[model samples]
Structures are given as structure tokens and as C-alpha cells.
Target: MNTIKNHIGINIFSKAILMMVLLYSFMTVSARNLKVESPNGKISVQVFNENNTENAKWFLKVNYFNDGKMAETISSIDLGLILSDGISFTDMKLLKSSKPLLIKENYTMPHGKSLQRHNTGNEVVFTFENKEKKKLDVIIRVYNDGMAFRYSLSGKGNFTVQDELTSYSINQETTRWAEKWNPANEGLYSSMVGEKIQQEEWCYPTLFQTKDNNCWFLLHESAVDGSYCGSKLSNKEDKNKYKITFPDPKDGRGKGESLPKISLPWKSPWRVIIIGNLNDIVASTLVDDVAPPSVIKNTDWIKPGAVSWNYWSSNHGTKDFKTVCEFADLAVAMDWPYTLLDWEWDSMGNGGNLEDALKYIHSKGIKPLMWYNSGGEHTWVSSTPKDRMLTHENRVEEFTKLKKLGVAGVKVDFFESEKQDMIQYYLDILEDAAQFEMMVYFHGCLVPRGWAKTYPNLMTYEAVRGAEWYNNGPEFTATAPVHNTILPFTRNVVGSMDYTPVTFTNSQFPHLTSYGHELALSVVFESALQHFADRPEGYYELPDEPKKFMREVPTSWDETQLLQGFPGKDVVMARRKNNVWYVGGINGENIEKNINIKFDFLDKHNKYKLRLIKDGKHDKQLVTDDSVIESADSVDVKVLRRGGFAAVIFSIIN
Candidate 1:
């Protein structure tokens, strides 16, 4: 009897102990084992998934926390590609995961660089196995402002991706700043609620606002240096769910296109979702952070400054080397760096002797930038006729010749597609141009997603409806104010833009605009190569003070700040270069509004001279007022009706 009782008691005690151990193990594994946070702990990210036996095993879900509150709930999404064939990244099981990695880097940016940034982040890799037990990995990185995730496939096999399996859910109402996916993505951006975004595809770097979180979110892809086709968001059956769509036979703009077959062991671009307050949304350097670093061993040759353009002004063209020299003279007088010889230079009837023109421009202490066609010279957007779309030996030949000719840069235009081939071609040119130690400008393409970081020689891109579009008609030019106001938060926030600003000539505008508005663009636009879209008369005829202001205002900046206003209504932006600050404001209202422009952005302890440039209250011309005042943080100013104002502040030396 004693033996029987002792044996039973021992068995029961052992079972109870085993159960407790198992329970403890499960809880430990589930308690946010895959977690990462930003340096300040202001942002937090957690990786999660569903593990039900009936469904796909590897459905990736992400949750984000801002300031200890949940900004995004477990959002059902996958950051993997599904091939056109039977192969898929789903039906997967966990293989292994890397311990969290801390990356802190500080790289000095050359001239025209912003911030000289110190990048800090946390990275982790999650590995999975397909149904056949083939392996793939997803990399997620968390920055102080946002987060990015990408897919990686390894092993020896060819795969053509049919699409990417990516989706995200918002925790707030769906008002988003939407730019409807136009093949030529040069269309203006408009705001719409989430439900309204159904069925319609919008281009990337898309912005979303959620009232619940009081935050802004921007979506885009980065580090896309030839691993996959370019992509945008899409949804068909459900408005609440959006997925990644690749180029199709029915692709708009890059119409009738098909994606390329990706080679083995390739990695995809980072699908980034940047979120923060307006400051984070505007100043977030996620794209630049995720991109490959500069490949050029010596970056001193990369120069970013103001450029004189022969296009965008009906009053200017490369009609002859003499006329071209006239533009070059303006660059010289303004102390600008380069003169762009645009498209018409290819026609002998319209100044085809570019080689001679380059020589003359160089002699005048200004380098030259010539234009070329891209994407097989497609003419759907009034592309240059039979212009050089160099590839293979031809591209090398032209580049070598141009390098020897002392060309400073090349402007490649009309990239009408986002197919893998088209995207790769852009990379090829960037690499080649870097090898020759010359800068390049991009036109007629989608907005840049941080390629400038990879190829530091790449200066600026014209992906916005700039001053050149004023030639279309009254309808286009009339919206200039509203358009300008919308850009700082939308297009310009993502990267630098060449809006070809400050057309001071009144006759140039068929619609209503003021010299104040013209002057404001000098401060508002963010082109590394600011194109002063004015004829010689535009500057030469201006008062000496105003001309000096245009010449001295910078194209690049050390910092930028948004003072006040909303999209399409009004905007006040403050930018700093060295010790000086420039403030610009624009309005789209029928009547003028009174607002306080702050000088508090300056050190509160400092005294400064503030120069105000605005429309005259009773006159057709512009006005200026100068005052030496101790910084009280702000001053009252008026933004004129239908246009805007500009001002500069310089510290007064004791």
C-alpha cells in the first residue's frame, strides 16, 4: 500500500511541474520577442503573424508605437514577392531570426548637402521557409522617425515576380494627399478621403493623415538599384486593403509593358512607411538613409548650385552660341555655377553646335550641362526627336567625349516607364556618370526615392509641374499659387526639385502673380541647381537690392522649418544657410490675410536685421522694409491676396 501511494503521488507532482514549465516557455516566447525601438524610445516597432494551421503560415503583421501609445495596430501585411510561376513566398515557416543590430553612422556630405546627418537605427532579419522548405528573408529597420522593410531571396534559381504581397491598415480616418497614378506622374496632387481612394491607384511617396494618431505617413520604395520593377499601391475587391502592383501589359504611361525576369538571389527595394508630425514628414531622410552610399571615391568634383536654363522660358532658347552665351553671362553675373543647354540645341536651326557652345561657356567660368533623351526616346510627352538614348558602347563613347570636353553634367529626360529595365537604365547612367566624376539631372520621370544619396553626383530632378508649364494656357498658370503651397509637404518633402523658380518678368505670366511671389520661389524651391527661370531683362531691369537678393539667396540649405498654413491654402517656410535665414509665404485665397511671421527661429538672445519683400499695399509693384530689432520670436506681417511674400534675416554683429 505504501509503495502504490508513493508512486502515484510522484507521478502527479511530476506532471504538474512539467505543465508549469511549458506555460512559462510559451509566455516568454510570445512577449514581443521580435521588437525594436528608436534611440529616443519615441517610436517602437513589433513583428507579429498569424499561426493558424488552416491558412498561410507566414502572414507578416506589423505594429507601431509612438510615445507609448499605439499608432498602428497589428497591420496585416507581407513584405515578400510572389512569382508568376507556382513559386510563392507564402506557406512558410520560421527558419531563424537575427538578434537586433544597432547601426550608428556619421558621413560628411559634400557641398549642397543638408544636415551632415548622423544616421542611427536598429535592424533585424527574419528568415522563413516556403512549402518546399526553400528559404527567404525579410529585413526590417526602425529609425527615430519611421520604419522600412524589404524582402530578400537567396539560392540559385530564376524567378519572375508577378507581384508583391504588401498591405497596410490605418488606425484613423482615411484622408490622404493623393496624386492619382498617372503614367506621366507630373499631375498635381489633391487630397481625398480613404474611401475615395478605392480602385484608383496613386503614385508612391504617398501621404496619409490619421486624426486618431495625429500623425502623417508617407509611403515609397527605396534602394531600388536594379533588383525589381518599380511599383505603386493598388486594390480591386476591397477598399480597405491595398497591395503592390507591378508593371503590366496594361500599364498606364509605361503602357503595354511587362516586368523583367529577376535573376537568382536578388533583393527587393525597401518598402518604407515614414510617420511623424509635420516636421518628421517633411524632414525625414528615410529614402536617403536606406539608399546605397556614394560610390565615387572622390566627391569633391560633385558640385550643386544655381543653374541658368535655356528651357522653361519662351523668352529664352539656345538659338545660337551667342544667345546661349547671354544666358551664360547671367550665370557669371549672378555667381551661379552651371548653364544648362536644353533640347533645342540638338537642331542646327536651333543652336546645334553644342561642342562649340560648351567651349565658350567654360571659358566664361561657367560649366555646361547638355540634354539627352531616355527610355528609347519615347515621344508621348513631346520628347526630343531622335536624341541620344545611349547604351552599350555608344553611351561610353559619348560620356568619354563629354568628359574630355569639360562638361559638368548631363540632363537625361523622358524616362516614360518604371519597368525593371527602365529603372536599371537609370542606375546604369548614374554609375557611369559617377565614374566620369560629373553630375546629372533627371527630367521626365517619377520623383526620386533617394538615388541622390547613392550617386552623390546626381544633383536635382524636374518631377514637378514647374514654371515651364505656364506656357500651356491660362488654366495651368492660374493654379500656380495653390500648386506652390501644396509642394513643400508633398513632392519637395521627399527630395530636391527643380521648379525653375523666380520668373520676375511680369509678361512671362499670363495669369495673376506678383514680384513678391516670384521672389518667394527663390526661398521656397529646393533644387540643388536652382534654375533662375528669367531672361536677362528679368534681372538686369530689377532694382539693385532685389537683384542682389536673388543672386545671394541659396538653392540648398542647412535647415528648413514650416511656420504656418495648410495644404492648398497657404504656407510659410523658414530656411537657414550658415548664419542667415530666409522666410517665404504663399496664399491661394482671393483676399489677403494677416499672420505673424516669427523671428524666434533665430536665437532668442540675438539681434538681427529683417528685410521684408512683399506686394505693395496700394501699388502694382513690390515693397521692402528693413528694421533692426531684438528677436522677440515673432512679428506681424501680411501675406498678399492670390500670391505670397519673401523675407531674409541676417544677424547683426555686436
Candidate 2:
């Protein structure tokens, strides 16, 4: 009887152990399942498995939330996954009922077939097979400010698997959309807090929409100080030969990459966005977030004002101490804060005397801003460097000496592109300059990411299509409207842009547009250090109405408004600083239209004075109105062809 009881116990114990092993295996498999979560909620991705093959099909949904409740549903789009290689498409379709509401046509490579060589090594052809699909993992996170998604693929797969011989292949595609979801719907439009709010009409995905293959991984945002999307190539061989390519003529002239090369294995893990209540703060914050904190150690170094220059407009033409000082005197007379002495004045390579020029500029009661170059082989007009070149290590030494010379700021140029090392170089320059209580302005640089907020010492960046290129050709004139219209929605959201506003006449091009257009830009664009690209003489040539407006214009603002219009079409922006409100509007082509100006932002009880800069019907010159009138509630004005308008609204102090 005892032996029989022992045998029964042994059988029960063995069965229990077997069950435990089976449960462990099940839990391990479940743990690897794909999932996505945001601050608001969780989404469990359903992975369809059939005959050892796994696939996923779902519609990505995004909603804008305010105070923990969904304010509006932003976008929803159907997404699918299928196994495909260079030749064959997998017949296995899991979700046939769902279809893409919007289909983007094939993107045309900008540089034609020549750009193919640029992609030679960097191509990541992900092959999806049963083994790899089973090991796939994905995680996506969305925030009020931005969104990020990451994917990891593992396991083995056979490529070109014939009857006997086989090779391996691998690649993956991740896509998301913003705004557009309902195909029949025209999209959401509303006015919020007296600012005209235009949500994206089409689904504007950030990183994946470039027409240039070389820029396939580059991400862009609509808001100037918003987030960016980027991708890094995974393969080692592709990484080494990675070069960016632009679109060539074979692609339709208008249909190609608008930007430059964005290499992978990016120095920074992801693109950034700067969020704030106002445009300048939003842009400044982005730059501060991406830049090293050392660059802006003390906020006191950053001083706000309009600046006059010798760099871009003069192009190192005014190297003489007498001539440069005369320009500084003009800046002082205008009540402009600082004057910049561009390249060729530095003694290290260009062999010009910096001390005399610095003394002369300071004597005029004006602060001087000098220019410097990164470690490039050529120094100041094709001259070779005498010292081992101005690298990051020695950047501080140069900055300290400039500080001793009483220089308030430096405009560093010719960085070319934002490589990992170059990104580090910019950070180092900002940090080292901060130690000397010096401000910085980057030219030929990437768009601002909000560094100004963190390191207020960094004033502005030149990333827009400014008046400096009017000399290029008539085509530039046509391109300017589109570029300017697009920048505010995209780049301006990032930080203060040194667009060098208010060029009355193009010295190089004889046929210039309306002077009022230039005056409007001063108010339309936001920058900490507003650069008037024209010569002092040029400002004098401008009509008194526009010129006076330029003199009164302020660079930084406490509040901003997108009064009307869309990207690449038209734009009207207004900014508020203290008790005054400055408004600007631009029409792309030679079209006459009436724009309604709303006074809803102002306190109803207070009376205000209105000053206007509008286009002259017969003269093609800007007409000014010093005539003060009490605001009844709102103002409606008519603007002329290729024309713009500016207004200053001030409270009538009792």
C-alpha cells in the first residue's frame, strides 16, 4: 500500500513541473509583443500570426488634449505591413478592408541617377520574413509638444531563397501623419485667442516626405520652433560612404529637395522642438535645449536691439578702420545697439589690424561685433592660417582677446552643415564665448532649435531666404515669397532667425519690389538682434513712412499672432511688446487684396492710437500715416500689388 501511494505522488509532481515549464514559455512569448503608449493612454498592437508569419495592421490616431480631456482629434490614418523585397510582393494581406485615405505619389530623387551613387553604401534594405517578423518590436510615444517612435528588428531571414541557394535581406518602413485623416473633410480651421489658427490641411509627416532621396530621412516641422524627425542608417558599409544629394533638373524644376544632406547616425539622438507661449520664446527654447548649457551660463550677456552690419552686405569690403568706424557712427546715430565688423579684419590670418578698428568702433559709443571662421583650411579670403587654425580648444582664447578689445559679440560662419562633430563645435563656441560674456550669431548655419532661451547670449541665426541673395538673379525674387511664407510655419517656430530684414532697394538687382514689403518684414520676422542688411545710405533712400517704421521696430516681442493665410501662399503676423502692437503682412505675387485687421486682442475699455504704413497707388512708394485716431473696435485696410502693410497700435495714455 505504501509503494502504490509513493508512485501516485511522483506522477503528480512530474505533471506539475511540466505545466510550469509550459506557462513560462507562454509568458516569455507574450512579453515580446509590440505596444505603444502616450501620456494619455495605451495602445496594444495586435500582431496577426498565420503559418509562422506575423503581421500588423492598424490606424494611427492622434488627438490634441487640453487639461486631460481630448480637445480635438487631430488625425487618423490607416497603416499596414506586408513582406516585400526588390522583386516580389507578399500575397498575404491581413487587413484588406482598410485603405489609405491619402496616397503620396512616388518621390522624385533630386540629383537624378547620379544621386544613386550617394546612396550606394547607406541603403538599408530590410527584408521581412517569418523569423524576423516574429522578433519585431515597436514602441511609440506622443506628447503634447511632439512624438517619437522606435523600432527594433531581430532574428534571421533568407533572401533570394530559390530551390537550393539562399541569401538574406532586411528593411523596415515606419510612417505617421498629422492633421489629415478624413478624406472628404476639408480639415479643421479656427481662430484661437485672437490668433488665426490654421491646422495642416494635408497630412504633413515630418521626416519621410522629402523629394530628394539623400534627404529621405530628414524631418521638418510646420511651426518655426517645432520638432524635427530624423533617421540613422544602421548598416556599417552604408554609414561610411553616406553623402547627401540634392535634386537635379531631371526632377521637375519645382519638384525636388528644398534643403540639404542629413547624414545618419546623427550626433544627436533625435530632432528637437521648442515650446512656449510666444514665437521668440519657442524658438529660443529649442536652441537652448539642443545646445550645451555652458554656452548660456549667464543670461545677462544677451542684450536686445537692432544691429547694423558690414559682413553680409559689405562682404568684407569695409576693412579700413575709418570706413568701418563711420558705419559704427551711423549705427549709434540710429540708436541701433551694435555694429558688426565682418571677416578680413582679424589679424590671425587675414593680417588686418583688429585693435585699431575695435578702438575706433568703441570711440563712436557703439559696441562692435566681429566675425570668425570654424577650422577650415582657408582663412580670410584664401589666406592660410598662421596658428594651427581656430579650433574649439583655442576658440575661448580668441573670444577672451576679443572681449578685452571691447567686442560685445561675434558672428561665426561657414559651418556648412550640421554634422555630429560640427554640432559639438557650435556648442563649444557658445560655451567658451559665454565665459567671456560675449554674445554669438551663427551664419551659414542650421535653423535655430531654441538655444536662445537657455543661453540667451546666443542672439540669432541666418537660416532663412533673406535679402542678401537679391544679387543672385530674378529667380531668387520669385523664390523669396515661397521661402518666406514657408519659414515662419517651419523654421521660425524654432527660435529667433536673423533674416536681416528691411532692404529698401537691391543694390545688385535693378528691378526691386515695393519698399513697403521690406518695412513689413521687420515686424513679420522675429529676431533678438534684428540685422538691417541694407547700407546706411540705403535706409536713407527708403520713403520716410517705411524708414520711420523701421527705426521704431523692435526685434524681440512678448506676444505674436498668425493673423491670416497659409504656407507658400501668404502670411500676416503681428507682435506685441509692452504696450505697443506691431503688425506686418506680405502677399506673394502682384495681387491686390483687402485684409481685415482685428482689434480683438486689445482691452475693449482702453482707447488706442493707430499708425499705418501702406502702399501708394500711383508712386509705388510706401505712404505713412502719423494721423492718430481712436480705435472703434477693428480696422480693415486695402493693400496693393506685391505690396505689404505695417501698423503700430499704442494705448492712448490719459
Candidate 3:
């Protein structure tokens, strides 16, 4: 990043030559500027000192380049470390800089865009010395489509973090998408020019698109351990500028939500920016790529599949463990793996028969999962607040007990706090639950920041506005069609989401959308534990064709591709499990529009059959498909808008 010029020698004095060599050596020793590039060489990052004058107040600047062209030129965006004892690291002296190193590794995920991916990147490490003689390292890594930088602090005493001065400054005309930072991730996603963002607080991975270059920027944090509170962008006078803000301290350290008295030997979450086209935007796994590897010792017992849950059937005959056992019968009939036992199952009527129910269900080869509160989740049923499990000891005890009872997993719900302590505590729950080989699902919490990569037992997360919202009001259900279409590209792009799709015959939810649309959700939403929000009777009453279709939907896939459509509009997605290909498309708009399915992605020579399921013009659940093609060598179909369509292709000749 520093400018170096070469002067050809014609006639040189001995003293001048010695001075030139000494100056060059000094510049090399300072080494305040460095550059690192991605493996494919599409992304570039440069860090440099902005001052070189006498009595210099040295500050660092970062610049990003895309395809050998300047994309963002951020200046004087200095890092900081402020302590409660009035100590500041903003004016730290650079100690040493390591040479850029290459990193590449292949990891398999239980569920995601693809089963496995080879993550490649290059990283540079720089150590800085503060006035207190304390030291910290700043590590920057660049991937093919993104980059991340973080502060690695190490010490003995509890560090009181008064402030974190990291910053992001981009172009003025960039459009942005983010909600006002809140305790819960329940708000709608709205996009506008930076200036139009009326709320001062902003959600993470807030997306932006440059007005000129067509380059995109998605900003967020990765591997946010328990030592740090959750963060979002603070309001700025210039809409293009954003800074990190933490949640308010519960211990009353009230100078505005700061990371209070905590251990110093911890690394802050990696501040990341993913850049590329919309496809890259939708498919980026940069968050998981930077997180630590699997902490679970035994992943063999962990499995992913569709789950039967009876909590949505308010008026049905389903109740407590008996209802779950009934769902298990459905799971057995469908060949699904598990049935989710909702909260208060331990104390409700027939709850005492949990062991007996488990005995029969286990004999039938169906696993049972129980739900628990995440420390603060209250209940109207027999469960009091004391039933909440917050400590590591509590989790181990309960998980061990459940394991003895032959329970397959636990759904921990209602985590109301985003403080770092709670974040760390939640992770500890997963780590301890791993000892019993139990799958974990998080609910009533923040959007996943790639924790599933570290804790593979964490099968799915429910931070989105999921199916449970339907019981609240019709307004909640009305916007669901569009919400379902938008989530895949937005919330789901980061990790596996628990948007619990497929609702049919819920007496509480009378306003139905489309049967074809509900069927397509078997492909649209990607969750290891796909809990269809319907009772056993609802599934049993279905026609044999639809019943078989629901039973065969794969929870995890070997590959996925976003075929067409935009955010909050329409989406067409294609996924594969082994040799079988499943295509699903949903239209979020009110008007009818035809979507042309492309076949070039399929195998050209292999004979394939197509089974079409399209929305009927008359009723919501009618499978009136007038467009079924069998024994096809190719793939192509047209789906109607405000509705949906689905297809499965196999060897018709076979």
C-alpha cells in the first residue's frame, strides 16, 4: 500500500548510497502496510498506515479490490480497545507483520447448499503493542468472494471492554437492507438507499449494492463466542458510515450496552464482508468457512429427517405424550425419523407415560425429541420458570436423563437475551448435549451466525418468523407466501433455518394459501428437522399421491441451485439427493406470471421422468395438474404465480 520508487544509478556518492540503503531497511522494518489476495485472485485486501510525517499519529486504512479494480476505498477506519480503567489502544504501535499464508480445507456439513465444500483463503497476521505494554493481534483473511478481520486479545485479568472502534465506510449511493436492531429477529426486511434507513440500529449481515460497479457487500460477524455481546451497526450522520454497537449490559454497566468485566483471553467475532454477484450473494457460506471446526466428538448418532409435531393441532384429539406417540405412529408410517414433543410434556396429562410411549415408539423405529425452555422461556402449562435449563450442569443432567429415556433430541426455546454471556451459555448447552449424542434446535433467539459449523449437533435454528406465527393472527399468515419466498435468499443463506413449512387442515388456521405451494415447501425450506405444521390426521387424510410425496421429501441434500426469481417476489429452487432431482417454485405476487423451468442443468443423456403437482384454479388443496410429463429425457416446466409447482424426476424406463 505504500508507494516505492526506483531510481537508476548513474553516479553515486558513497555517503548517499549508505543513507539510501539505511532508509530502505527502516521502511522494511516498519512494515505498516501489507496486502493479501484470495486463492482465485478475484478479491484483494490492503491495510496501510495513513500517516508518515514527523510526530505521526499513525492510523490504519483498508481498501478492497474486485477483479483487479477498486471497489471500496475506506480511509482512517482505525481499530480500538478501550478499557474501564481509562486505557485505550487506539494509538498502538505496530510490532510485527507476518507474511500472507494460504489456507485450504474441505469440510462436510450435515445440511447446506452442498453436502461438502472446499474452503480456500489467504490470511495475514499483524501484532500491535499498546501503551500498557499489552499486545493484541489483528488477523485478516480473504476468500474467493469475501474477507473477514478480527481482534485477537490475550491476557489474564478480566477485561472491561468500554468500546470497540471498528468501522465501515462505503460509497454514498449504495442501497441497503436491514431492520432496526432488536432483542428478537422477528422484523420484516426492507431495502432502500442508505439515507432512507430511518432506524439508527441495524441488523447484522446488512446487505448493500454499489450504484456504479454492480458489486455487492454483505456485512456481518462470524464465530461470535460468549466473550462478546451481539453487535449491530450504529447510526451515523453519513448514511454510508456504520460502526459496531453491542447490547446493553444487564449488570448495569450503563454507559450504553458494552461488553462488561470479562476475561481478556478471547477473540472478538470476525467482522466480515462478502462480495460478488446475486448468485454468490445467495450461496455464500463465508460465515461457516471462518468458524471453528466440529467440537462434537461423536456425530455418528446425529441424523437429519422430517419430524412430526402435534402442537399446532389445538382442536385435534392430540394431547401430551399420547399425542406425540400418535405422531410417532405417523412418523413410522411415513418412515420419518423423529417426533417433536412440545413443551410441558414432562408434567402434562399422560406425561407419566413418556417411558411407555417411548418403548412402543422405539420398537416401531421412531425417535422422540422433547422441548425445553432456554432459561427464560415461561410456560402456561404445568411447567414453571424453574423448568428452564441455563447452566452447563443443568444441560448435562437433563440430556443424560433424556438419553436414558431414548429421546433423540431437544428443542431449546425462548432465549430473550443477545448478550455475550447468554451466547456463550447457549453454546455450552450444545457442547454438553453432545456428550449424550443429542441433536439441538434453537428457537426464540437471534439469527444464526454460523454456530452450526462449530456444533454439528445443532441441526436447525428458528430465528425466522416461522409457522407458529399463523396462530397469532391472520395478518401474520397473509404475508407468509412472500415471507416464505424471501427467507431462502436472506435468512436461510447463512445457515439451515427452521421456518417449519407445510400446513394443511389446521382448524385454527382457516385461511389457506395453496396446496401446491405447501407441497413445494418440502424443497423450498432447508432444515434437518423438517416439522410439517400439521396434525397426524391432516397428513393421513391426504390422497395417496400427496402422502407419498410428503413422506419422500429429503431433509438434507447433496446439492442446491437457485434457478430464478428475486427477494420478496418469487423463487425457483432445484436440489438433489443422490440421483433424484427435486424442483420447487413459489410466486409471492398477487398476479399470475409464468416461470420457465430450465433443463440445461440436468444430465442430458440419462432418461428421466417428471411428476407435476400444480395449484388448481378453484381450490387451495386441489392437485389438479394438467401438465404431467413422464419418461422425459430433459427438464422444463411452467408454474403459475401467487401459487406454486413441484416436480420429481427419476428413471421412467426403469
List lDDT for all candidates, in order.
Answer: 0.73, 0.49, 0.72
Clashes of 3: 1
Name the runs in model 1 displaced over 4 angstroms: 1-31, 50-70, 73-75, 111-115, 250-257, 349-352, 375-389, 506-509, 618-620, 629-631
lDDT of 2 by residue, 482-542 (tens): 5565555554655567777677655565423566666788877777788887777777666
Q: Which stretches of candidate 3 lie over 4 Å from their true place?
A: 1-33, 49-78, 92-96, 129-134, 154-156, 236-238, 250-264, 315-322, 350-352, 376-388, 506-512, 619-641, 651-654
Off by over 4 Å in 2: 1-145, 148-268, 271-297, 311-313, 347-353, 377-389, 543-545, 618-620, 626-632
Q: What is the per-residue lDDT of model 1 for residues 223-273, given as tens digits with 9 covering 90 to 100?
A: 876767778777564555667777655543544346657787788888887
lDDT of 3 by residue, 2-45 (tens): 22222223234566888788666547746544677788776767
lDDT-superior candidate, 1 or 3: 1
Predicted model with the maximum TM-score = 1
